[model samples]
Each structure stands twice: as structure tokens, then as C-alpha cells.
Target: MNTDIAATLPGATKTHRDESFPVASRLIAPAHRAVVLAFYRYVRAADDIADAPGLAPEEKLRRLHAFEAALDAADPAVPLARALAEADRRHGCGAAQARLMLDAFRQDAVKPRYAGFAELIDYCTRSADPAGRFLLALHREDEAAQGPADALCTALQILNHLQDLVKDRERIGRVYVPEPWMALAGGEEAFFAPGNGPARRRVLDAVLDRVDTLLDTAEALPRSLRSRRLAAESVATIATGRLLARRLRREDPVTGRVDLAKADFARAFARAAPALAHLGFTSDAAVCRRIVAGSGSSFRLGMASLKGERRRAIHAVYAFCRLIDDVADAAAPAPERRAAIEDWRREIDRLAGAPLTPVGRELQAATRAFGLDPAEFHLLLDGMAADAAERVRIADAAGLDLYCRQVAGAVGALSIRIFGATQAHAFALSLGRTLQLVNILRDVDEDAAIERVYVPLDRLLEAGIPDGPATCMVQDPRFAAVCRALADEAEAGFAEADRLLAGLDRRALKPAILMMEGYRIVLGHMMRRGFERRGPRPRPNRRDRLRLVTLALRGQP
Candidate 1:
């Protein structure tokens, strides 16, 4: 199908926001509105040429290339291209996305028929992927999310084709229905015939199912975004996609009209209203996803193994933890830092009421959805407050455990709830301690530079070390023994965690299991290097990931 949405229904261009399709809506930041509209105008103009009733194939291609020339520099005659180029320069929106749309339009000018679904999907890569990638670049979102966004855009594109199939065939001899699909539906001529209503709807039902799954997968994209505007806008898009898919399934295309009222789109906007705010709005889920993907590669990998809502909830939890860490670690006076921690604790107290930030709203949503306690969140803030207090010093094993309980164990308990593991508090605490121990040992040098040490002072003194940084002390024979002891402690934590994991339903705990295995792998590498500076740190390489996959599959530690 031609990429122009306006081409589907005359006068639709004036009401793009009300249609079940993507456009820069009122949700976009005011500063970004002009650029987004420029991009749309550029693509819309190209789509117009490609779908024009009078334009020859060569003429359409020439006009598309004119847009490319505008991208390089200003074009007085091509106003749309000039505006798009200005948007690209200011927002870093790349010209490659525009070029991609051009390819789709050029193809549409000549190739009107697709032999198979694969061919049609390939067409969508150029046709649909560019629009989404354009939005990503405009908002400075991560490239990792573009694939999911593309899948969504392609599904929308397919839905549009299915809606316009008859109109396309009658108007321009374009046939989006693949030959195989027509053959299976009782041959091409019969399938398109008015008499073959049941057979056509049956075949279209299979295609509609595929669109449904794609739209479902696309739900992850909104949370994966960094920009609040983009995230909220994406939520609106997803709402529309879901509603349209239902319409396609319930209503017959051959006989019944699939006209969605403005009110239907209004309901979709209502469903995703969590993202809008007084000035700007963004999805908390999207914000958390960006934080996880940006902060830790290993944990993100493990979490990515989760499906749909489970993955989103965990990301929100991690994002909260990361936010606490940031507040504690911010460069400021100790008193101010402590005050910041207190503020977060108070937020947890009144979390049941209106939220003041995207993160708060998202955290509240996760708590309600996953049965998480506000006390758990408050405990996490207290842990941060511990580090914020005047140059934190751990004097003994009990002190270290107290610190770990507040920071890691509390976090583990929350994660347990999210992952559906009950009565695993002890196991969760052990996992947190073991992971914290690994991090402390791995960052010994870096931590010492900041005058912060997680190792117990008593243990260091017992090793016969005087007043000196642990960075240099870790090299001594007596301190190496302490390192060995610390490694042993971490191993025990892993063992306990593994034992608890053995009792839980294996499928839901896969992400947590992967995380444990990642740390265990690091611990093993640390032990081999005698827990020294040269030891491998806690990260999952391809080989480690393969082994983790095997462990998850076999349900073993």
C-alpha cells in the first residue's frame, strides 16, 4: 500500500490525531512540534507523488529524489524538504530515515504486487521502519528500541493495507494480498469476488492474528524510550493499534465498514493517560527501561529474557533502585545528600496519592500490579541514606550485613514479588548480599579512591593491615586470605540463593536465575585469579550467556 495515510480516506489529513495511526499529536513537546510536522510533511508529500493518479513512475521517482537533494542543502522550490533538513540539523534526526521512506515510495510507484508475506514485510522495513526511526532520532531515544517500534509500525502498515485492499485493487491494480493467501482462500478470482465472503474473511483472520502479536510485542517500545513525549505518544499509538486489531477481527472487510469513530480513538488515549502531565508526559515504564538498558549490560540481558509485563515491572523496580543510587551518589554536601534520601522516603509514604514525577507514578503502578510494598521502597531509600551519612565505615560483619539488608536484600524482596516467588525472603537476601559482595570485590580499587569500603574494618585489622587504602592492602598475604574468605562468603550466598531458586516455579524465575549465574560466573573467574586486580569482573559474555541459557533450560544452577 502507499505510505500516505491521507490517501486512504479523503479529508483524513486534517484529523490525523483522531485516526488510529501515528502522527505528532498534541502530546509532543511544543519545541519539537515544528520539526515533527516538517518530517511528516516531507514523507506525506512523497507518499502523495507515489500514490498520485496522474504521476508516472519516473515522475514520482524524480520528486522523491528532489526531497533527498533538499536534505543536502536548501531547496527554494521544495519547501517541505528544507523544513525537514532544518529539523534534522536541530534535533539530530538523520537523513537516512528520509532516504528510507523514499525507497519505499519509489518501489510503490512501480511494484504494486507482493508475491508473499516476506516480500510485503520487507517493503514495510522501508515503508514503516523509517517513520518510527525518525521519531526515535527526533526524541534522542536508544537505537535498541527501534526494532520493536518498527515491528509496531509494520503491523499498522499491514492493517492499513488490509483495510484498503479492495480499494487499492479497484483503483490502481495494486494487490497486497499475496498469491498464496488468495490460493488458500479458494483461488484469486473467487477470493476477491463478492460471493466469497466467508473464505476471504477466514484468510484475513489469519493475517489479523499476526498483526495482533506484532502489536503486542510493540508494547515494550513505549517503556524502552527515553523521551517522555515519545513514550506517551507511543502509548497512544499502541492503544490505537490494539483497538484497530479488534475491529479487524470483529468486522468483515468485504461487507462491513471498519470505520472507527473519533470516540474510539479517544478511548485509546484514555487507556494510556498515565503518561500525560501538566507540562509534558512520559511513560514510567519507558523511563525505567531506558535506565536499565543504559546502566547495566548483564542485568539488562537477564531482564530482556522476560516476556511483556514481567519485564516491564522488573525494569521499574530496577529504575527505582538506580534513582536511589543516583540521589545518594550525587556530588553535594553530606547533609544535602541525606536530605534528598529523606525526600524519597516521604514519597513512598504518600505513594497512594497523586504522583509528582513519572518515576513515582510508575513505581506506584508497579507496586499495585506486582503486590510490592511501600515499606520495601522506603527500606531501599534508608539503604541509600546509610551511604550518604558522613563517609560510611563498616566496623564488623554484622554492620556489613545490615548495610546489605537495607540495600540489596530489600531490593531482592521486591523483585521476588514481581517474579511471583513467595516465602523466598531469605533466599532473596542471600542473592543480594552475594551480588553486593561481588561488586565490592570487583571495584575494590575504584571504591578505595572514593574513601568508601564495603569490607569490614575488623577483618582488615585482623589481617594485620594498618591505616592504608584497601586498594594496596588487598595485595598483602594476610589480606589475600581475607579476600579468599570474602569469596567463600559470596559462594555461600549463591548456594543459598540457588537452593531457594530450586524450589520456585522455574519459568518465572528465569531472569533472576540468569542474574545469579552471571554473578557466579564472575565469582568463579575471581577465584581463579585469586580475587586480585587482574580477575575478570561480573559481566556476561556470549559463552557465559550460552551457559546461562542451558542452566535456565535444564532448571539447574
Candidate 2:
């Protein structure tokens, strides 16, 4: 190799043995390992040039473009590129994946800060997702598995960013943690400060939770693969990712590297052994079920009573809602939020045709099977749009009602259809409003922390409190009176639902009734605790869960 070519491969000297990911591990067949290594070497070479310290950005771009052109021309002087081309000739592992990664390295040469996680994901689409795609292509895995594989790769990439947080900032003058996310920790400086542990922990944990959601999407990847070796490898890799995420949660990377021990590898591979015994696939419905169960949702307890397709349908619905809610609640700009919502809107339009995302595909099946109204989904989107604003404020009682109707009542309307009790739409709508009010009342401090106030502006005025910042509004003594008034309204709404439930088909609406009773218990706690007492918001205890379970089994609401 020429000296210039050798210079370009400075970072490529470190082999897969030095990396965290199991790149071309022994699990891969001997026939395929050479090609995988060839691909890794090519990517590693480009990454080296992009990350080389003291190198000018212009020089990095020129070298990367030259290397990319070299691969296209099958230039022999660039040994890694020639090797990959030869592998592609034998095994047909296309060069497109490597080119996407080169694009990412090109970006890395100039870009240092990400505006938001969405932008970071776009970066990952090039930097990380292609690696998974390349592996799947090599193993001849179905394209249907690509979503989960992309998720796994992206999750791992984000976790790497988290672990390298301090080092990336100090060494490369780069910060992959989004600027908006850092704002959650008080600002970039405070976010990295040694003394801001609690605030920093909250932000980091939120990022880890997002990673956990990605891992949940990835849980299906191993099972979906046709090759046993590849399946086992994926299983072990996912286990390692989960272990690292957990470790990152307990230990801060700001102080130093937070990584897995050698024992973790044994544990991960041991966890993968049972997977070899049964490589049975998981369906989209099962994936949605796992997502809902893992979410620790309050609705899970109520929805558990329904068996078979009804249960699957509700899980699909809830998962869709949860995903959209996450989009709305993300710490992003208003336009970005709206753009994400629009993307979902387009997805909704495609439901009757063929939606692209896992959640969308599952939702499409549920909507078609159960005759779920798409209009209700749009209403839910509208509600999310309201919340996705720069700040959330309710002008009056009617505004609150409309907001509830869009967010929760729309959910209720959809739930009744899936519950096989369309006749109980009125009851569903009433209960939805009541449940949302209780949620608003209980989450006052939490909502305030996020710059949201569901307390009506008129109610605040009536309490002699001026409309202002959410945190300020929640702190006033008069705010408790405002909450009490809403709680009374919620109590009345619950009574209306109870009356409506009495006249309906008790068997079909058992799930809805159980949820109603559960929320009523929460409302009871709030009433007894009093809004004036500022402690943890009221929630159902373990005894309440057992009682709900009993009621569910007995078919008694």
C-alpha cells in the first residue's frame, strides 16, 4: 500500500478484538467471516480518517471522497476497499451499506452538536443502521427483520454515545447527546458538571428509557432470523446491550467509562443458549404486547382480562397511543414535533393501504379486524398536537373538555369498539373524561414541571390567581381550590359512567368497568389526601391491584 493509503488507514489497525460489538465473531460461518471482516475493515478505515485528531475537515472530506471513489473504481492501492470489492464479488454483499457509513463519517468531520434526538437518529440511519442491514443481507435474513435490526443497531450506537459522553466532548470537541436533552439537565455546562448528579441522572435515565424502548423493538430481531448462528449472535448482542444500559443507569459515564465486565459476556451468551432450542418467531401483535407490558402502564391491569384477539387489538391501540404520546412529549422544537406528527398522519393515511412502521402495521391489522375508526386516531393526533406546543395551557372549562375529548375520550370511543360493546360509547366517553381529569389533578406538579397546566385559566381567575407560568400557577394556595373543583367534576363524571355501565352489557364491557373502578379508587385516594397536602400524587396501592384482579375474575365491576 502507498504511504498515503496507509495514512488513511490509521484507525483501521485496531481489529474487531478491540471493539465492543462482536464483529464477525466465531458464531459466523468460516465462509462468511472473511467477507464480514473485509466490510468492517473498509468502514474502520473511513472512520479512522474522519476521527483522526489534528486533521483538517477539508482534508478528511477529500480523503473520504477519494476512498469512496477508489472502491467504485476497484482501485488496488486501497487494500481494504479492494478486499471488500472482492468479497462482494464472491458473496454479493453490496457496497451500498459501506457508502452510507462513509456519508456519516463525512458529516462527523464538520458537525459536532445535534439539535435533537431525531437529528441524531437520522445520523444513525447512515452511521449505524447500514451495519445491521449489511449483516442481515449477508445472513440472507428477510427484509421484514430490518426494522428491528435497525433499532438494535441504533440503540447500541446511542449507548456508545452515552458511554463516551465526556470523552467525546473533551477529546473530539463533539457532543452527541442532543442540545435539547442537555437543556433538561439545566444546560450543557451544568449537564456535564460533577455536582449536578440528580438532574443529570434524570436526563440520562430518560435517554436510557428511550434506549430500552428501542431494545424492545429489537427483541424480535433474533427470533425473526432464519439462520440459527445469526439468531444466537443477535440474542447475545441484545442481552449485552440491555446489561450495558442497566449499568449506565446505575453508574455515570461523566466520571469515566461505564461498560460491561467480562462476566457480562458469559452471562449474555448463557442467556442466548435457550434461544437456540426454540427459534420460533414472534408476531407483530406479540411485539405490541411486550411493549405495553414493559411500559408499566396503568391500563395493563384492566386490559389483561380480555383474552385472544380482543386483547391483541387493545394492545395494538394502546401501543400506538403510547408511541405518538412519546413523539409529542419529546424535548424537541415545535416544528419538529409537528413534522413527526405529520409523519404519523401520513402513516395513518397508509393504514388502509400498507403502513411502513411496526406500530403502524400492527395498528393497521387491528383497525381492519376490529373496525376501528380512523377518525378517532386523527382526534388523538390533534390532542397530541395540542400538547406538543411550546407550552400547554387550558383557557377554560370548555377548552379542557375539548382537549379531553380529543386525547382520552377519543381513546374511549376506540376502546368500546374493540371491547365488542359499541353500545357503551357514551359510557366510554364519560369515563375517559373523568379519568383524564383525575390524571390532570394528580399530575399537577409533574405537569407544571414540564410547563403544562391543565387547570383552566378561568378557574384560576375565579380562585383570584392570575394566569402565568405553570410552575408559579401550581404553587399558589388558590391552585388547590382549582384542583378540588376539577376533582368534584371528575367524581360526577364517574357517577355518570357508573349509571351508563349499569344499563350496558356487563360481560363485554368488563374491561372498561374494571378500569373505571380502578380510577375511581385513585380518585378516592385524592379526595381523602386533599389537594393541599403536597406529597407524592395519589395512586392505587398493591391491595387495589389485587382487588381489581379479583373484580376482573369475578366479572364484577
Candidate 3:
């Protein structure tokens, strides 16, 4: 409460009561509550000093160093630090974890902009992760809980950064939105301009997608905790994070303050209540199901009849493909995309060891259960790296085939094993390529929007179009000729898949047949519309979904 000391001023006196989400509250037991508060106060004081206006960066650094020294020496002059030191002695919440936050605050005193999402995430690991780790340590929760807790904490911090975007920029001259992201909106100036709402919203939504992925990983935190009270608290925190993320997505933070209402907390607590009794926790299967269902992919319809582990295995495969595909097509610089791909590569490599990501953990189990090959996943990543370029163009039919085999065909190879159809490799390869070709036809306009033309360069040239920008190639009259020829090849591929399907076990390959039928229907739609026509690709309607489900039930599709 002292105002004389630079780091002890009441100017930054916000408490747990003032936070957007709960800090240390009644949810924490009385035995642990005081120590949590002490930790919060120490960190909050350092954050305030770093954000203090009219103070030189050197002065902020000096004050922060003094706070760290106070903790080291148990100096009472810095009352919050002294309190935290005493609390640490009692609770064993490591000072090392608390110092990570001090380091982040010190970075904030000097660093005003983030280079990219990865850099921003690194910042979050220091600024936010330690808080969750502190609680985990205090409660003596399993070390495995730390990964999900870090995920939840980092998500909360990013959500806070997004909510405080305008305020942070206007008040402290700091901008947490990655600079590369701003570049995508035409530059930092245009990105922040009031008139740039639509562009800013697109960028913000991409950031929110990243947040959603983090929340998905954090979904395990509640179930990972052993202490009933902490489990309940974590469930509430995760619910609050998810609600706030959705709110941020719908409401533009740039236009005004977008945040949660008091009712939101009540709703989160209501959602968390079931967890206190150690019930209603979401499992890895549930997370995978959500991902697959949320995608609106036709494959979900095919997998509908499966139950138990088989269904979970299918969902796991589809979710892995969907997530990596997201990384490939993200609205980021190519280098950043490639870097993200590398991170995925590392995650895939960890499957045999201790994997940190939620999807990876689920995948490891699925692979082990199904005897799935891990090498196929690396193949998928290789294909994604090809697409994560500044511009994408297939050189020829062979090139196209290789790309499809790597991406879609590899998925088929994995899925068939999960389907228990071990001998369906030929069927899987044929249908995968056929479906990918249909995808290329449907996504010509959409892919061109991102400077990607999956139509082979040789085909384009033979159709009398030049090898130039993807957008221009799509507009050329000759483009339709190339598409028609590819459509014929796709039809043949489908026929080959059907022939191969007849030789395989129908019971085992039912899911593949259903998916092939769905894609065939889409192909028929495109053929009827003609390749010359240009517009949004037709999506399966409710009627289409019902028909597919019917076929699946009949064991015919």
C-alpha cells in the first residue's frame, strides 16, 4: 500500500476482485488462499511498475530489479515481495516460477511489439504460465497437469491481451498483436485505423483460432487435477476462458471494450459445479468428436455409425488432419507457417515419448490401439510444408499425384487401419486422389484467393493459359478445359476405387465406401454445374446429409 517506493505504489493496486477472471478466491481452500494472494500481489505489483506511464524504461527496470532483490533478501521495504517470500516459505510455491513473471514484466518495460505468434506465445509462457504452475505445485498435482494448466493460463493471457488491445496501445504505447499479423491487414497503421474493422476482425479471428486450439489443449486440465477443489476451480477457469474467447470473437475489441458480464461467471460456475463431484469431465474422445463435427466435412457423416474406440480412432485421425491443415493454410508469413510445421514435426516425434499437445496424446493412444504407422503422419506434414509456401503450383500430373498421396492418401492409409480394413490400401489411394481432385475443382476460386493453384502447370499451359498468378489462371477461359480433363481422370479414379472396394471386406470398408459415395455426389454436382461456372462451391445441404446417413445405415454407400 506504500506510495513512496516506485514499485510499492497503490496506482497498480488492482486485486483479485478486479480481474476479468478469478484469481485466488474462495474456490481455493483457506490453507492455500493466503499464499496464492501473496503470489498474485507480488506479480501484480511488478506488472504495474512495468506499465507505469511517465516512468523511463531504465527506472522501470531498476524498480523491477529491486523487487526481485527484495524477494531474494526478504526485504520488508518492498512489502509485497516480503509477503511472497514468507508465503513461499510456508507453501513451497517456487520463487523460481515467480521470477519467470518478473522476467516477463522486465521484457514488457522494453519490448513493445511481438514479431509473430510464436514470439507472443513465448512471452505468454513467461508472463502467464508460471501462475498456473504455481498453483499446480502448491496443490501437489501431477506434473502432467502442468502442460494443460500452462495452456489454460496462456489462453487467458492472450484473451486479456486481445481485450486490452486499444487500451494497451493508447495508454502504454504497447501492442501485443503480432507485427506480422498487422502486416497482413495492410500494415500497423491500417490495422489500427478505426475504418479497418473488417480487416482487423479477420486478423483477430485468426488469433482466436489459435486461442481455440489452446483451449482445446487446456480441456484436459480439470481432469488432470486430483484435488477436488482445484479440479472444480480449473473447470470454472476453463469454462470462463472458452466463454470469453467466444465473446471476443463475436464482439470487436477495436471498436470498444469487449468483455464478460457477471452473468458469464455465474454460467461458468454452473458449468464447473459438476466437476466438483468429479463428474461431466470432457475426455480426449469428446474433444476429437468436437473437432471433426465442427469441420462440417463429409467424412463425419461416413463415420457416424461407428461407436466406442473405432469411432474415437476415426475422430482422432480426422482431427489430426484438420489441425495440421489449419497450420498449412493459416494467414501468416510462409516462414512462420513453416516454423509451425516444424513444431508439429517435433510434436509428432514426441509420440513415442511424452507428447505435450492434447491431439498428440490422443493420437499416441490411437496409434498404439490401432497399430497405426507414425511415419504416415510425417508424410502429411511434408505435404503441408509444400502448401505453406508464398505461392503453390503443381508442376504436372505426377507432381499432383505425389502431393495427393502425401496429404489425402496418407490420411486414407491411416483411416483404413482404424477402420480395421488392413487390405484396402489400393482402394484408399484411389479414393484419396479422386477426392482431392474434386476438392481442387471445388476450391479453385478459394485456393486462388490464397495464391494457390492446385491445377497442374502442364495442364494450364496445354489449355493455353500461362504460368502466372493463381488468381489470373482461374479467370482464364482455358482453366475450364484443364478442369474438365481432371474431372475425367477423377471419374476413372473413382471407378478404380469401386473395383478395389469389391475385393475388400465390405464390413471393414463400409466407412470408406460411404465417404467415396459422398465425394462422388459432390463430383456429380460439380460436373452438372460445369467447370466453366465460377462461384462459391456447392456444399452438402441437410438433405444431402440425411441421404448420406441413410446410405451409411443401409451399408450401401
Candidate 4:
């Protein structure tokens, strides 16, 4: 098998162009990209047969069954199967495990809605769990490590289904709200009706409880991936998952869409980096598995480097942040995402102390120790949950201010507890708010291109411009004036950010300062470019980042 031929296989190219996988992300390792791309291509081909438009149901089923038959054969001739065989001969790709994906893809033809929890888990076993197992096999993770990876993958799949209920229903006419739950909520007839409040709430709450359990099981993956780099990735994945879960719980999924502001994502990643790095190097899969499965003992060991209770507290906060983020970004359709976010908002209102998980318990302890405001945490969660469902266009500077406060300012308040700010929280929050404003301005064109208009409708109306892209507004003198005004407001936020930095504890201020200064420089560049355009995105370059780092060392504000 020629490795290059196998790498750029025609089938792989078609699959890369498919929508089912994030095949071309910068996040994937270059070494693994080709194989993963091939695997995705195979899966996409199978999925397409089962889902292609205008195909009769019987025909779809027949094709899927035939595909499964090919997988069971000793010497399959199908493009994907042939490619897999070639990869197995050279790269040692796991033939048996790859076949498992084919088996799972076959389920789309016959099984749509699950009967119950056990049946759902069974589906996950084939569809979701196998992908993680295959990835582990590729990485040579042993049985011990495989266990937690399987659990996390299954959990993620379940969460994805729950999030995508609306879109799934619209696309396939299949509802994943289990039969039992639907029955309890007055059967499918009432459940499917729009604005079926009682039925929607009951079904959502039940699903959320189950998802919470799955997340608990999945949370062990980071501990299982004990190597520092792997642990960081695991933490990032788990944190993102947890964040989505939190959004689902707080928001009414029937109506809201959840999202994590870029700034919030940055802050959360920075906060989790220390604990993730502490996991160190380890090759024993059994030990890694034990760490993930055991809970408190493993968590304590993972955080042993921290002095006193702060270690546990920070861990809990990081975990909570991860959970909430995941909920915000669950793979659900926009409507379901919105509903989940609304539910999440309610959950935050009811939150008293962190729950019993190691990270949660730690966070609870920290809140008590630091006298943190519950409202601030609640507000942050509210903001995230709200973003999941709502997509309002910003009309003017006032609208932009509101957007920044909800997305960025809320995060700044939470960071204060972790980093300790005393009188600086307000200033830090202003900086955060400003950074968010800058983001909105920089991404104005990109956002509108995605059918997301962040420019306020009022400003558009006032400028005698039609409500649409910033480009249209730029052509109108009045609308361009509104754009400039919004930019000036962002500049004001930057000034406030500088003041916030002045009040920070220097030792604890490096990350926040670096991030703020980076945003400030970008804003300066934007101002110089004449805020008249909204199509191209403005971002800082590596050289600019390096310059910012140097400036940080000089203690220059």
C-alpha cells in the first residue's frame, strides 16, 4: 500500500467535503489527520445512504443493511472497506474497531427513537462509544484507559442528541424524547405541539437528569488521560461538555440557544491549564483508568500540588465552567439549544452551593472562603444560557454595551473569585466588556456572513439604512456615524480596562493583563482602519502577540 495514495484517497477527499465531521480543524494532529479523514469519509458515505433525500424508506434500509454486510465480509471491495484494509496493511489502523463504526451506521436505517435508557445506551455502545475506542486504539491506550474514553464518548453522544432534538425532528421526523417520557408527558401528540409547556418541561427535566448522570460518568476521562498533554485535552473536552450541560439545565431548551463568548472560552482555558499540567506523565493505563473511575482519591492526587484547600476549590470551579460551556455549545439545533439554555438559567437561580463532585465541592468551599457573590456566578450562567437561544442584532452602542456586559463582564466577575481582585473586579469587568465589544466590531462582517447581524436595528433605522449587513450601513453616512460611535464606546471600554489593570494584584494579573492588552492593540488597529467596513475579520498576528508578551515583562500599562 502506497502511504501517499492511501493518504489522499479520492473517497477521503469527498468525505472531507461532507458536513458530518470537523475533518479540517487546526486542532487535529497532522500525523493523525489523514487516517481520521479516511475514517470520516467512510462514515459519511454510510450516513448519506441512510439519509439521502428522495430515497424511499425501504430503499434506505436495504442500502444500509448491504453496507453492514460488506463490513462482515472477510475481503470487502467497497471503497471505504478497501481503504481501511490498505491502511491496516501499512499504518496498522484497527480493522476490527473501524468495522464497529460501519455496524453503528447501519442503525440509522432501523433505529431512530430509543425505547428506554438501556436501549439508548446500547445505541451509544455502537455509534458513539466505538469512535472513542477506535481513537484510543490508534493512540494505543490500554483497556483501563479505554473504559473512561468509552464512557465520555457515550455521554457526549447522548448530550448531542438531547441538544439536537428540534433539528432532528425537523430533519428526520424522529423525536429522541424517549417513549416513556413522552407517555408521561401525555404522549407524542401533545408533546410535539409547539409551546407545549407542561409536556416540554417534564420531558426536558427528565432528559437533563439522565444527561447529568452521563456527564458524571464522562468526567473521569481527564483523570484517565494522565499524561500532561492528554490531560489538558481531556480537561478541555470535559470542561466544554460540562458547560453545555449547565446551559441545558438553566435554559428552557424549547426556546433558547446557548453560546460561550470567545473571551469566556479564553478565560476558562487559562484557569484550567494549571490543574491539567499537574497530572504529569504516566504510561500505565490501569493506573489512569483507576484515577478516572475512583473520584475523590484521584482528584486529590491530581490536585496534590496545590497548597491547602484552594487546589480543590479551583478544580471544582474549572469543572463547573466546563460543564456550563458544553451546555452552551451542545450539537442541538438552534431552537433546542435555546430551550436548554433557558432551563440552565433557572438552575443557576436555584444554585446554593456547588454539588458533591470533587470540583464542585472544591468550588463550594472556595465560594464560602472568598465570600463570592452567588448572584455573579448565577449571572454568568444566565448570560451563557441566554446566548444559546437569542440572536438579536445590535442596533447601536447601547445594544453593544448590553451584549458585552452579558457575555464578557459576567465572566470577569467570576474570574475575580479565582484570581482575587478586591477593588479591581469592576475595572477587570470593564476590560472584559471592552474586549467583547472589540470582538463584535472585528467580527461584524464575519458574523453577518453567517446570517448573524450584531449591529442594532435601531441604529440601522435611525441612519435611514435597511437593517442588514454592516456593509450596507457603511455606505450610509448616518449608519457609518453609528458604527463610529460604537467603535468609540469600545475605546472607552479599553480605557476602563487600563484602569482595571492598575488595581490588580501584579502577581495574579499577568494573564488578564496580557489578554486585555492584546485586545487593545487589535482595537487600535481597527480604529486606524476606519470602522467603515464590516466584512473582513481583524485579528492579532504572532508578531503582535510576541510584542505584547514583551510589553508585559516591562510592567507597562
Candidate topping TM-score:
3
Give the candidates in order of TM-score, highest first. 3, 2, 1, 4
> Against the correct fold, how does model 1 do in TM-score?
0.50
Worst 10 residues of 4 by lDDT: 1-10
Clashing pairs in 3: none
Give the per-residue lDDT digits (tens) of candidate 2, residues 201-299. Answer: 877876776787688778778877888788878888888898999899899999779978889888887766766765444456776886797778888
The sequence of per-residue lDDT tens digits that candidate 4 reaches over residues 1-557 is 22222222223224353322223333445676567666665666666665554556676666665554454442345666566556556566646665666566566655667666566777778776776766666656566666567766776676667676666667766666667656655676666666786556656765665466455555555556544444555555555566666666666555654444456445545544754556532222222233334343212322332334544444554455555655554333345545555554554444464242333334455677867666766666665565554344555667667666766776666655655556677776787777777776776665553345666777677767787554454456565576677789888877766665665675555546666767777878887887655446566688886776575565433
| Model 4 ranges with Cα > 4 A deviation | 1-331, 339-369, 395-399, 468-480, 499-508, 534-536, 554-557
Which lDDT values do the candidates have, in the order given? 0.73, 0.85, 0.86, 0.58
| TM-score, model 4 to reference | 0.48
The global Cα lDDT (0 to 1) of model 2 is: 0.85
| lDDT accuracy of residue 234 in candidate 3 | 88
Cα TM-score of candidate 2: 0.91
In lDDT terms, how accurate is model 3? 0.86
Residue 278 in model 4: shift from native, Å? 16
Q: In model 3, where do residues sit more than 4 Å from their true spots?
A: 1-10, 541-543, 555-557
* Candidate 3 residue lDDT tens string, 1-557: 22335434536658888898888767788889888888998899889989987788998888888778888877777777788998888877757788999999999999999998888999999999999999999999999898899989999999999999988998889999999888988988998898998888878877887888889989888889898888888888888898999998899898889888999999988877888789989887788888898898878766776767888888888888898788788777788879888988998999999877778888899889999999999999999999999899889989999999999999999988988888888888888999999999889998998899999898788878988878888999888988898889999999998788877888778888788888888888888889888677777678877887787788544
- Model 1, position 313, has a per-residue lDDT of 82
Best by lDDT: 3
